[model samples]
Target: MDDPVRAFLEANHGAIMTTLKKDGSPHVARVVIGLVEGKLWSSGTRKRVRTAHVRRDPRATLCVLSEDNPWAWLGLETTVTILEGPEAVDQNLALYRALAGEPEGLDEYRRAMTAEERLVYEFTIHKAYGMH
Candidate 1:
């Protein structure tokens, strides 16, 4: 396992397209990610379809490929764990601040979110593979 993969993920916590199955086929969609305590964290709005699918099945695969180098890819297969309530909300806010360069007004943005509106999910990273 390369340590840089984790570092890369933390530094570039952008949208990653996770693939799951529906009706014996595959479905891929982009999602925002946060790195909290070395685990991959994400959330979904109530309107997002992925949230519903995840509830039904927690298994997912996340792929992050380098734009400048196709050969360089980081992939992980893991089970999703949903985190709800106040603790999750605070963790998400902290993650956002860390990955988003600690931008100004972040405190206000985090403060504006209600406890119910924030849904945090983490991937345990059961297995990870990559090529540099």
Candidate 2:
């Protein structure tokens, strides 16, 4: 259809639970994500399994279930880029706050997080498709 990757993300902007094995195989879990600058972004602690997989392999696939038809699904293959610096954190925090609808005191929460503790991973869409 019309760029299923962007369509899927626009329809569902939430965390997407992704699976990545040490061997480089990947699986995707639907999760809430924040969209900014035409990219899909998510945050997680370093202790999480997905975080570990991303650390090993930045390539990931994301899938979102279709609401109009439960039998349908959209999938995207993307390259993940992990942001771990101050500036990147700020940008990601702004996007996160906007997506979360937390207007007040988000800056404080973002400031409390350390650069490493806050993982801002961006998924660059490479290919996308869907099936019904």
The candidate that wins on lDDT is: 1
Q: For candidate 2, report its TM-score.
A: 0.75
Candidate 1 lDDT over 49-92, as tens digits, reads 66666777888888766656656767888788877666755777
Show model 1 residue runs off by greater than 4 Å.
Answer: 19-22, 67-70
RMSD of each: 2.7, 3.1
After superposition, the stretches of candidate 2 with alpha carbons farther than 4 Å from their true spots are 1-4, 24-30, 67-69
Candidates' lDDT values, in order? 0.69, 0.68
In angstroms, how far off is 73's CA in candidate 1? 1.3
Clashes of each: 0, 8
